[model samples]
Target: MNEKLRVLVSVDLDGAKARVKTQGHVTLQSIQGLYDVMKRADSLVPGLALELDMTLAEVEPQALEELRGCARSHHLPLQVDPLQRDYRFSILAPTLVALPVAAPMLAAA
Candidate 1:
């Protein structure tokens, strides 16, 4: 499994804002990489406002919380796109529900 997280950074011509897009799974180990990229982007333009897009990525709950904390304490002026779904769930519960059930005749075919 490729554990690497890909980060793409873009800054506006005026250097007043920066946008970051992340792809791949974001685990505890990879959170640092994401933070570093954000820091670098901020340095490029002092007081740069950052917008983070994680729609293309899956982030572990712990990592997500840590990222939020870091951003809050550092005052990164970051705005993150909302996650599609909540990751916190009961261990006994199914990760997916309402799965399609194929017809019995189809199995025999």
Candidate 2:
């Protein structure tokens, strides 16, 4: 059975951030709705960070990962509250750094 997806967007009074609350089941089929809501929120408050609260929503693991990937690729500051106490998930994007290579050691003659 297909579950209904509910998305609510609310911006802060200072207009510095927007909070998106989602309820019901969040699957691949309903991911577009979530994205649309986020897009609209971003347009309404350009340059502001978005916080996604999925505490009350039932989200598929794959869909959750996809959302994180999308947020990172788009450089969007998205904070997610999965509401699962057993496992912890970070919403912040990880920083990538290049390590220097050491010179190869010469064999003894």
Best prediction by lDDT: 2
Determine the backbone clash count of candidate 2. Answer: 0
Residue range with the least summed lDDT across 10 consecutive positions in model 1: 85-94
Once all C-alphas are superposed, what RMSD does model 2 give against the true structure? 15.3
Where model 1 places Cα greater than 4 Å from the true spot, the runs are 75-109
TM-score of each: 0.63, 0.63
Among all windows of 10 consecutive residues in model 2, the one with the lowest summed lDDT is 81-90
Best by TM-score: 2
Tens-digit per-residue lDDT, 8-39, candidate 2: 87788495778788777777768777766776
Q: What TM-score would you give candidate 2 relative to the actual structure?
A: 0.63
